[model samples]
Each structure stands twice: as C-alpha cells, then as structure tokens.
Target: MLRRALTNQITRQQFRFYRVNRSNTVINFVPQQEAWVVERFGKFHCVLDPGISVLFPIVDKIAYAHNLKEVAQDIPSQTAVTMDNVTVSMDGVLFYRVVDPYKASYGVENYGYAMQQLAQTTMRAEIGHLPLDRIFSERAQLNAKIVQVINDSTVKAWGIESLRYEILEKGDIHLPQSVMQAMQGQATAERKKRASILESEGERQGAINLAQGQRESIILKSEAEKMEQINKAVGEAEAIKAKATAVAQSIQMISEAIKHENAQKAISLLVADKYMDAFSNLAQKGTTLMLPTSVHDPSSMIAQAINIFDTLTTKRKDMKSIEASNEDKKPEPEK
Candidate 1:
C-alpha cells in the first residue's frame, strides 16, 4: 500500500513539473513532431530576448527582428582617412535597424558591431579627403555618405540596414569669428574694388565717346562750311562765265550783222540821225559847225564828210580790237 501510494504521488508530481516546463520554455524540445501534441521540439536556437524562431518545428530555419535601440546607441561621431594616410575626423549620428531578420540574427556576430566598425573606418576615410567645412556645412551630404558606406559594407555580410545619419557636433574643429569677419571684409572690399574699377572704366569710355562725338560733329560742320564756300566760288565763276558768254554772243551777232547789206544801210541811217542831234546840240552851244557856205561850194561839203568818216572808222576799229584781245586773254574752263 505505501509503495503504490508513493508511486502515485511521484507520477502526479512529474506530470505537474513537465506541464510547467512545457509552458515556460520558449523553445519546445521534443524528439518527435506531432500535430495533436501541445509542444513540438527540435534543436533549440538561442533567441536574443527578441530574435529568431524556426517556422517549422522539424525544418531547420531561423528568422527574427531586432530593434536598434535594443542593441546599440545611435552613432554620433566618427573618424576618416586620406590618400596621403592623413587622418581627418568628424562627428555624426547613425541610425540603423535590422532589415533581414535571418541575416541580422545569424549572418553576423552582431549587427551593431559591424555598423560601428564600418562607420568609424568609412567616416575617417571620407572626412580625410574633404575639407572640414564641407562636412560641417550640412548634414545632407554627411549622412548620405555615412549610410552608403555602412550599407555597402555590411548589408550583405553584417545584416545592417542604415536608415539615417546626422551630424552631431564638431569634435576638434574650430573657427574664430574675428578671422571669419576679416575674411568677409576682405571679400567685400575686393567686390567693391572691382565694381569701382568697372565704373571708372565705363566713365572713361563715356568721356572718350563724348569727345569722339564732338570731334565728328566739328569735322562734319567744317566739311559743310567748306562745301558751301566751294559752292559759292563755283556760283561766282558760273555768273562770270554767263556774262562773258553773253558778251561773246553779242560780238558774234554784231560781226554777222555787219556782213549784211541791210545792216549797213540801218547803221548808216542811225549814224545820220546821231549826226543831226549832235549838230543841233553844237548849234545851241554856239560851237562852230563845218558845212559848205552855199550849195555852190560842193567840194567843201565833201571834204568835211570825209574827215568825219575817217575819225569814226578809226574809233570803231579801236573798240573792236580791244574787245577781241580781252576775249583771247581769258583763262581756260575748269575740266
């Protein structure tokens, strides 16, 4: 009776302990998988309080998710290198999380470890090549490069996915305001000097243009005056030529008229009328008049008429010779 009682109690205790263990254990451990069994078992994998699980009890597979905050802090500052092997440093914050749970859990020893290691090295390399100002100027470029380097190096291997990064604060870099102000002032002065120089050049060019305009105006006006004077001289010369031409035409007409018998009769009639007027004027003035004393003295009238004809012919010939000589001595026409 005592042995049976002890056996019953032992059986009940074992049942309770098994039930408790099965409920509490995160990974069920059993030698066989059964559809109706409350728990199934396989080789147990360590789950990081929040890591991976095998979807099938008997199938060997691991999958999980990890929060970045559960693993490590955001990256803030980092270092870099240059081709010359010089070291340059900068500060920034890094953000990352697990994108692939399988890789996050199994592909790498630690996701945070890979990110940190890569971030430090890449930051140093990038910062070394760039001047400090470029890195310090803005977070946009710095974050992109940091995430790129981290993702490229670790996503395939370390299971790290870079979400974002940012510049925190400069670590060793320093700039003095006085020096910056001096640089700004120098730049301003240089701009002003250039502006002043351009303005002076423009003014000088304007003055030169004004002088040229005045010179051109003077030259044009002088040329106009010269043309006017030349025109005046040409006009005077034309007037003189016209007068001389008229005189020549008159002399030619006279020579042609003198060849006509009627013209000779007209001239003789005009001379007789002129002699009558001269004789009357001489008689009124009591001047002596040469004439025959009576119609019987015919030889005296002929002698007086002969003397008057000789005097008039000599004077008329002298006037014609003077006119011809004047025509011969004139300058040639302008070409």
Candidate 2:
C-alpha cells in the first residue's frame, strides 16, 4: 500500500510538470502592430495584443495572426468600357489596414483578396459612369470615390479599413491605337486654335495703338498750325496799325508846313523843278507829250500848282465850317 501511494504521488508531480511545459510552449511574444486571434475549444476567444501573452495549452489556439500595419495590394489589370463606349485597360494599388482582428479573421475568407477584388470592381463601375476624357482628367476624384466605395462595403463586413486608392501614373491606362491617334490630333488642333487667337489679339491691339498715335499726331499738328495762323494775323494787324499812325503824323506835319508863307514859296519852286524834270523824262522815253498850249512856261506850271493847293486848303476850311454848323444844329441832351 505504501509503495502504491508513493507511485501515485510521483505521477501527480509528473502531470504538473507536463502542464508547465505545455503552457510555456503556447506562450507568445507578439510584435508591434500585430494581433493574434485566439479560440478556446473551437470557439471565439479574446485577442492577444502586442507583448507577452499566454494561452491555455489545449483549450486556447491562435486561430489567425493578423498584421495591423497598412498593406498595399496591387489590383490586376482589366478592361472596362466607358460611358462613351470606349474600352480602356487599367491597373492600380489599394492601401488598407486590419482594424479588428476578430472580424478580419472570420468576416471574410481573406480580407486582402476581398479588398483587391472590390477595388477592381469598383474601379470598373466608376469607369463605366465617366467618359474617356473625364476618366483621364478626373483621376483624383475617381480614386477618392473608389476608396469610399471600398470602405463602405468592407469596413463592417470584413474589418478592413481602406486608407486610399491610387491609380498608377505613366501610361497605366492603355487605349486603342485609333483612339491614341485621334487624341493626338485633337490636342494639336486645340494648340493651333489657341495660338491663332493669341496672334489675332496681338495684331488687333497693335492696330489700335497705331491708330491712337496717328490721331494724336494729327491733332498736335493742327493745333500748331492754328497757333501760327493766329500769330501771323496778330503781326499783320500790328503792322497796319503802325503804318496808319506814321501816315497820320506825316499828314499833320505837311499841313503845319503849308500854313507858312516861306514854305509856300519853297513848295512852288519845288513844283516848278518837278515839272521840268517830268518833261525831260518824257523826252528821253521818246513818247509824244500832250500839253495845255503853255508848254514852254515853268512859271505857268508852278502858278497852276500853287493855285490848286490853295483851292484844296479853301475846300478843307469850308468842310470844317459845315461840320461845326451841323453840330450846333443837333439837339442836345436835357440839362
């Protein structure tokens, strides 16, 4: 009985040691940005976070180990028809991360594969809604829409959070040869049209500037001519006024000289000399002269001139007396 009792005690000790070793074997040192999904007795259990974690040797099992870091999945190239009925083949990348390990492990067969397929389908659907031109121009908006669609479909169902979607650049989309040629032609025509418009605008502006310059020049020239004409008119008027003043002064001096007796004798002798000189010039010209029948008498001609001068003086005195009488006959202002 004592030997049997001792044998049982040793078996119990051996069982305890095996359990310790088995538990040690199941211990996990999880790294950062990782999660381990645990199951107990083939049922869902708690998730093992980063750092040291222990599990029941037989009851607990690491069902799925998920990396919490973001993942970039390449979408396979596929052809899709656009709204305008043009076909284009395209490929891109999808960025995602596992947020809930529990759902990621059980929600879908494979979350990464599901995300890739969803992204591709979403891209094709979006392409179908847009024309070929819009597809190329609206890539950013297309990517954002794709990301939104993907997250909406997979966030709650697959525990996958789509960070973003990006269509690769550098000719990722392949068009038909005919489409490529057509697009090239269209681009060339657009550039030519813009160049022609710009050229025409430049010529129009240049013509306007030239016209303005010519107009200004003509206006300035006319203004200068007008000023010259005004200056000439003013100078001519001043000259006429000066000539009138000089003539008036000479006439007054002549009248004063004729008022003296000696001056009258000197004027009569000057007239006789002028009459002889005139006859001498006529003889030199070899022209016939008509005389008053007293042609040889210088005294007769001087006396005739003196008599004409006295007659003109007598007429002037008579005119002044008549003017004075008319002035006295006019009515005066009332006192």
* TM-score of each prediction: 0.38, 0.60
Candidate 2 C-alpha lDDT tens digits along 1-335: 99978965664454231111112247788779888778889899888899998777878877777888888888878899999999999999999998888888888865665677689899999999999999989999999999999989988988889999998886589999999999999999999999999999999999999999999999999999999999999999999999999999987987899887788677666666777788778878966767666667867877776777668767988999999999999999999
The prediction achieving the highest lDDT against the true structure is 2
- Candidate 2, residue 321: Cα displacement in angstroms equals 23
Which pairs, if any, clash in model 1? 30-41, 75-93, 75-94, 76-92, 79-123, 79-124, 80-124, 80-125, 81-124, 81-125
lDDT value for model 1: 0.60
Score each candidate by Cα lDDT: 0.60, 0.83
Residue pairs with backbone atoms closer than 3 Å in model 2 (clashes)? none
RMSD of 1: 19.4
RMSD (CA, Å), each prediction: 19.4, 14.2
